[model samples]
Target: MIEELAHDPQSGAPLSSVKNYPGPEVGEGLADVQTQAYRTGVRTPEQHPLVEWSGTREGTLTNGELVSAQRGLLGYFRRTHRNVRDDPDPSMDSTAALALKRLKAEAPRALDSFVWYALAERLAAKGYWAAWMLDHVIARCPHPTQRVDGEVVGRCGSRLKFRPGVGKLEGVCAKCPHEHGAVDEALVEYIGDIYRASFDEEMEARLL
Candidate 1:
């Protein structure tokens, strides 16, 4: 996804109006740091000294280049989170893991907002959304586990509920008995709008 966005070649003209979008504001401190990094083509040593550019690059990077870098960082976080979630290994002290831990500790709210933004983008693109079914929920399989080739692999006759958000299954399936039926169309559109506005803000902050 980062690569695709980097090579889009669209000149980013369509995002011009993103300047006017009214929504959540980026943190002043973070915005200042980002702008400085974009202008100088150098991340602060104390803040992000571990960041290493993949290619032979020199001099200050343009706004587009900085945006690409930001996207890359976000993508790295997404992959690291998935890895840590799916396979827990306490001894594995990888750079991604350390960075994730630092982000969680230092900027928990920003991390949460970014996660939501990423989820909204994915759900909107896939034409599906999730909703909370019950105030208190339990994970239950209606049937016993099925063995595949002598290994218990799958479950049969299970009415699996879709889970949204992070950390825990905070929400239930949209197709539950209550008929939540996906997120509202307006909300989904607004999510997209927020994403665009945020991206534009990040990319255009130096100008401001």
Candidate 2:
């Protein structure tokens, strides 16, 4: 689904207009984002904007932002929304709420995807290595166990630390100390068939 926002003649506030659209085509998406750039302006020619999100839900506003990208949401989630009646103003997240809606239409839990929240702490920390995530929520190493003269046994299922902000996506297994080089490149091979990259430059900019 693609949403095009039209400015109101009376109020001049951008209105979210949804229209039926097919797969993630670069040109079509760029046009739509150009209209609703106020929601989340992720204009990077190298990638599609994933941070600009919106969904259809009752009482749901049209402009929504991803927690991974939204600075206010990152702070809100840092507090875990405690003692708060409503989400921060201008940070309304109807966009993320409809994540499952889009997924069900496509695969229905059949795919393993990156959980941006899983790295909330890391992302909020604004470290040198951030935003490079693609594995499942609980991403871990699946390398076979290796023995250095009978020192280790079983699968090396340790958490992998990702550094995608360093101009490339790299994962380092904690337990095995194994390095998974260029996981981003590995995923890029399946872009048209098994994967589509929805990128938002706004998220990256916030970190900077």
Candidate 3:
């Protein structure tokens, strides 16, 4: 599901103009992300932007590069949705499954970069539910990071003093603000959008 927003003739606000058309192609990386999300039960048919973009859920909005790339991601996932849902591949190697396990265990400490957030917001503005869902998953998962003492920490901050194996995260929850809630549901959608943009950029650069 690809949604393009243009100025409405009557209202002058961005209205659903291209609701009928099938938007654009989301790419393979995004497709993989969508598949992973589906297997994990994070994404739902309702949340997916396959049928129409307007009906999907809302999360952060991302525009420009991220937005364009997200469209490619949507297209790719749409194809995968059809393939996996229609025919289950028994021999499939679930790499995303392992990645999810790590993500759940590690827990990310930070949100995406400022630029990434901006892109996500733009996608939301355009009514891309997958954007919100994907971002949520990554945001909720335990972010991976290392400590000065050589041990791995889920939440790292200035207040916490991590020792090699003894001291864990003793940081103030309020001091380091990014502790939003779990959004594991959107992991696949978000990754799909990111991967599509990367692949497309590489392809375009090579052609240039």
Candidate 4:
């Protein structure tokens, strides 16, 4: 999504909409699945740029960091996307065929076709994977975020890409320093609504 202003939830709070320049390096090597097998929680380059930010340094992300971020994003999807366990599609009507196809198209990572099965019946339902669906629909978010340092507080005048539920660990301008950011619920709901329309309109899945 293009960078958009965040809104306040109580008073039209804005969601932070980050649109990072595509990572500077092309990803090489495979996403680290072995590490994901045991590790927990989301890990991303935005959280660990693997650098010392004195607020004066300017350089592109190292290739390793790019891989780390991609792995983390895929990991985030794996952890969150709905599965057959969640649905127990005993009858396997499998509108599954089409949705899985869409997911393969949507996922940034490319792996074996069986890979999506790990997430199970993705796209079967909305909000079941709200964050994943959100990755696509969160355009022009109106959530509110700010920057504060000591007694100095300033309205954030710049935009950074937002990673759904991942906190502003990496995308907030490194120069700004305030916290307490919140996702705009109304905006999240609005995005879900439109996406749901498209999903229902074109997507027809088996009961699986």
- lDDT, each prediction: 0.32, 0.33, 0.31, 0.31
Q: Residues 1-208, candidate 2: write the lDDT tens digits.
A: 0123122211212334443222344235455644444344321111112222233222223233211223222222223222243443222233333332333233322222222332322333433222323211344443435667773333343556776557765766655443543333432332222212232337757988
Model 3, global lDDT? 0.31
Candidate 3 lDDT, tens digit per residue, 1-208? 1112212111112222222221223223456644443343221122233322443323222221111222333333333434445563322213222322233233232222212333344344334432423332112232234565774443321222222332543212223336522222233354454345433446757998
Clashing residue pairs in all predictions, respectively, total: 0, 4, 30, 28
Question: By TM-score, is 3 or 4 better?
Answer: 4
The list of candidate 1 runs beyond 4 A from truth reads: 1-53, 57-66, 69-74, 82-84, 88-189, 193-208
Pick the winner on TM-score between candidates 1 and 2: 2
Give the per-residue lDDT digits (tens) of candidate 1, residues 1-208: 1111221111211111112222224223457745553344321111122233333232222233212233334443333334335653333224333333434343232322233343334333334321211111222222224566884333221223655545554333323514432333323354354455434445557887
Which prediction has the highest TM-score against the true structure? 2
The 10 consecutive residues of candidate 2 with the worst lDDT sum are 42-51
Per-model TM-score, in order, reads 0.21, 0.26, 0.18, 0.23
Higher-scoring candidate on TM-score, 2 or 4: 2
- After superposition, the stretches of candidate 2 with alpha carbons farther than 4 Å from their true spots are 1-87, 104-107, 110-158, 162-169, 175-184, 187-208
RMSD to true structure for each model, in Å: 20.8, 18.4, 19.1, 17.2
Off by over 4 Å in 3: 1-129, 132-200
Summarize candidate 4's per-residue lDDT along 1-208 as a digit string, tens digits.
Answer: 1112111111111122332333323332435632331132211123223222222212322212211222233432332233313753323323433443444444333221122332232444432433333432222222334335642122332333454455533333223324424424533453353344335544455534
